[model samples]
Target: MSVLRLVLGDQLSDDLSALKDLNPDVDTVLMAEVRDEATYVRHHQQKLALVFAAMRNHAERLKGRGVNVRYVRIDDADNSGSITGELARALDDGAHEAVVMTECGEWRLAEHLAAFAEGAGLPVEIREDRRFISSHDRFRRWASGKSQLRMEFFYREMRRETGILMDGDQPEGGRWNYDAENRKKLAKGVTPPDRLLIPPNAVAREAMGDVERLFGDHFGSLDGFGWATTAEEAEASLKHFLKDVLPSFGDWQDAMAEGQPWMWHGLISTSINLGLLDPLDVCKRAEAVYRAGKAPLNAVEGFIRQILGWREFVRGIYWLKAPEYRARNFLDADRKLPWFYWSGETDMACVADVVKTTRDNAYAHHIQRLMVTGNLALLLGVHPDQVDDWYMCVYADAYEWVEMPNTRGMALFADGGIVGSKPYAASGAYIDRMSDYCGACRYDVKSKSGDAACPFNRLYWGFLERNRGRLRDNVRLAMPYRTLEKFGEAKRKALAAEAEACRTLLGAAPME
Candidate 1:
């Protein structure tokens, strides 16, 4: 029987479940660059280029392996512009007897694919994606009866299961976490290594051209598109990270310089999310580096934790509480995301630098995401939906499963502490300490009020006051709450008013 096998842009792995055990002679691999996905959340131009180029490259690989392949480009004259529309049109030709596909990445696409399966007329088999280390069933079983889920605890379990960096039954170096050591600011004149760039190949250049012509209104620039478009390129990038950058990764992982965006981060997230690089392989190699004494235990452990801990943990949590999780507004924040987010037209040096980096490279390391843009959005009382949308829109590595939890749970505290122990809200002092953006800023980081004062200073206290009823009793927040209480009722009210004024001036607060 001839079966039509569908491959989504993100499912480019050679060993994808749907492609396993296929009779290439009878099975035709189907891949398409559909319009709905590219424009779904106004995905960044680099993100669009990366996925489309990768998809095109993977299709050629399959064809080279003697597989019959049918590939559709975004600008094809007969394109139907949607996944289901393309699938239905393919089935209407009666060339194939059945349909097969691996599961999709996002909730919206999953629902759409499920609906297509229900009515596709032919028998359809949607197989599990085994690219990730923790399967959906594995994560669900791990989280079955927990009152509250935490990534640290879940990460330990993953360590035990994988035997990664485990010294017998205990963690390597007698500690499971090296996050404390990872927070040191970059000392003056200490520079990060230049990032490895994969110059756009012919296939990638075609995709980039298509993105510019079609998605001209997208959020980011395509000027320096350098993302790996195939598994081999991704592996090469990973190798460079381990050799040149991993040694100092733990020491300056959280540090941010004015023009430095990479800062010792492993820039393989786009590769992993796109299935060009396997997550477990990335973790195992880092562990091997620690065992070989090439990289410090602190650096290797921190790097592994991101993949084996937070990355897997967030994916599990996303499936556990999604659809409902996205609707949460525990703080009732109602401000719109400001225009400066798009234009980078604000005096806040940290935000402007990060936004510029995002537009240019379609990437900013985690600290830039969480501490800079994400922190400011939470303080300005931007609604969770707006915050989530912006994060999803701008980054090359963003897919719903990873982006939503980080935005609502870690960044905005909109999910009310499900994905994090406490909101990552902070004042300008934190930025002043970790980065040099404060030194060049027009506003004073130490001041607590007035126009020339840093906006984060006033808004930090306001976030606490606005959410007091919900957060006052939490153990993690006791210190901040006590500090707010010491300010007296009058001082607290004044802080709230100043915060409101800052939000209004920043255009975060909606005009009535």
Candidate 2:
């Protein structure tokens, strides 16, 4: 029987699992730009455009390869505004006898598609997404007896399994990680290498116009929309990163600079997450660069670890614990997100820079996301749901599988140390050591109290003081708790009061 293969916006690869066994003559590939997915989170305008344009381009490429495709535009006259609605309409039109789709990256959409399949009165098959090196079941077996699921241990096993950087069962250069060497601050007077930016083509322009007409008031701007919208463009981007930026990527991957949003960072996550670039392929290329003496071990290993290790590990944790995982707010953080998160109206130079970069580019490096914005949210005690929603909405690369784990587990420590052993709570001094933002800020990073103090310094102690009962026993946080104890009651109270005033100024509610 002929099949209707459903391809999601992020599942744009030609070798996608659902399309692997496709009989081009009998199967009809179904791609849709549904309002349900786009409006689900008020995604950034550039994010919407990028996905829509990529999907359009992928469908056209499939047609060129002689595969029958049924494409639905968001503004189609008979569009039902949802994935299930569109699928049902397609089924009723009697184009195919069975439905086939690769499992989606999100729980909400996965559940909806599963329900539609059961009710569609047709044969349905949901294939495992084989895009990653680790399968869901394989990851589950590896996690079956572990007390703690740590990415480091999982990464070692992945190295052994793939033999990517393995030297006959041992890691290359006598180490599995080069993270320590990857934390150097940007060198003074040294400029970041320029990155390749793919201008929006006609297809991307139409997609942008659609998003502007539909979601103009969304949280981000589309003025500088230059993300890769096709597999070819994504490949070109990878080549550019390997050649120009990978050498310095390790040295400054954790550093942030004023007005330098793309400082030696690979801008390929959106394309990889969208299936325009293969993760494994990208990792191998980085490895090859190292083999050819083009980049250092720190650069290559760090780059590979992000894709092969963290990326796969997060997907595993998301699938293993999700639905219930989304509600895990171990910190009991209930404060609302600050308004400046969306508006970039804050006087905090570090935060304002990150937010402005997000608004303009729909992107930020991991440190800017984790230390600046995510750290601020965690210290301010923003609710996990609000934090997850904001992160999911603003980044082009964000999907629930990846964003949820990073936000709730790593960033907020909302999962009670499931993803991170400790809350990434830090004083402004950490940022001062890593970036140039402190030099230009109105508040003093050196100050620990009062109105002109960096809010991070005040909130750092306040978070520890407030969560001591829950976090004091954590070994990783022992020193911070001990330091808090040394501060005595008076100093702690003063810090708490200062933090409260800072939160109030930011329009966040005082901790109850």
Candidate closest to the true structure, highest lDDT: 2
The sequence of per-residue lDDT tens digits that candidate 1 reaches over residues 1-512 is 99999999999988999899889878888899999998889999999999999999999999999998889999999999999888987888798999999988889999999999998888999998899888999999988899999999999999999999999999988998988888898898888899899999999999999998989899989998989999999999999999899989999988999998788999999999999998998999998888888999889998999999999999998988988998999888899999999999999899999999999999999999999999999888888888999999999999999999989989988888899989899999999999999999999999989999998997899889988998999899999999999999999999889988889899986623
Question: Which residue pairs collide, candidate 2?
Answer: none
Per-model TM-score versus the true fold: 0.99, 0.99
What TM-score does model 1 achieve against the real structure? 0.99
| Candidate 2 lDDT tens digits, 409-480 | 999999998888898988999999999999999999999888798999978888888898999999998888
Query: Where's the lowest-lDDT run of ten residues in candidate 1?
Result: 503-512
lDDT of 1: 0.92
